[model samples]
Target: MPSSFSSQMLSSGGLGLAAGLSLIVAIGVQNAFVLRQGIRQEHVGAVVAVCAVSDAVLITAGIAGLGAVVEQADGVLRWLTWFGAAFLIGYGLLAVRRALRPSAGLEAERAATTTSVAAAVSTALALTWLNPHVYLDTVVLLGSIGNGEGPSGRWWFAGGAVLASLLWFTILGYGARLLAGFMSRPSSWRILDGLVALVMLTLGVLLLVRG
Candidate 1:
């Protein structure tokens, strides 16, 4: 009986990890921001830390049943939707400006536009916190699914999800340097920034239209 229970818990944890990765592995605004910071090699550690820790908190909240609370908070969601849309639009404009500017090599541009650590951290926080989808995925969806694991199994499930977040951010932030050779050209930066702008703008507009 004990062994059977253990097998079920392991299965639950594996499912949690898979579900978390499925939701998170997409190329969204937060991922784009993290990739850019990683390429720039500016405060990458801090950015990764922020993202991982935020995920941990949210996942834990979900596992602890805060998801139900969030679901009932219509006013909070509305406020976040409006605020997030505004923030994304502003950030998207910056990306557009970067894309339009005369580009330099990635390293040269990094040197020229070296952002303060605090500023980078602030941007990371904003990117992680402002998006309503983050709440929905981490708190509502993940939470509801985790709660289905029953009390003891839910913690293991949350652990698996948190581990996924940590592994993903660490690999993305640190391993981004591997693409330095390809992203060395000035034109590469322009293309990347343009894509980032499009993503941010589209998400922002969608939030406004849908919300």
Candidate 2:
């Protein structure tokens, strides 16, 4: 490819990366779940892979014009919003229970039987797919923006988005281990679970209210 074309692709990819991260690097259920798994160090790889791969697929689909199809499905998203909200609220309550119970803290988490890989993967998928914002942000917003970058630029932008997803999840899922030592205390885990509970419940209620 010509140097000019190469430069354009690079620019597009950088733009895509920034945009993708902007939408992703926020306090969300997906990030919270991934972080929790990372701290537990159970099936961390599977969770990260599911999240990254899911993002790539969604981003690609959005840019490929499936976003238009999604745009026409307002009713479906509303239903999903209800379901997602219910799930988040339920999960948040579980987190609340975990926080309230000292036995459920990270200090004793190691002795607890880890969840199956299939269960982890399933939860990851639900967290990714259930959120209506995922479709609107990853598909509709990113799709429109990436598609506007022209044909070649669109794919380059998509590559950047996929890269961002991989990079962020890898960092978040693994980097959280650095805190494993500090979080070894039961109180710390309690606090973490409490925060998770707050996030989940807040997001859940907001989803329902917005819907």
**lDDT per residue, candidate 2, 1-211, as tens digits?**
6997999789999989999999999989999999999998989999999999999999999999999999999899999999999999998998999888766456477566378999999989998898888889999999999999998999999999989999999999999999898888888888888999999999999999999
TM-score of each: 0.96, 0.96
Clashes of 2: 0
Badly placed stretches (over 4 Å) of model 1 are none
As for candidate 1, its clashing pairs are: none
Q: Which run of 10 residues does model 1 get worst, by summed lDDT?
A: 103-112
Query: Where is model 2 more than 4 Å wrong at Cα?
Result: 104-107
- How much lDDT does each candidate structure score? 0.90, 0.92
Assess candidate 1 and give its TM-score to the true structure.
Answer: 0.96
Worst 10 residues of 2 by lDDT: 104-113
RMSD of 1: 1.1
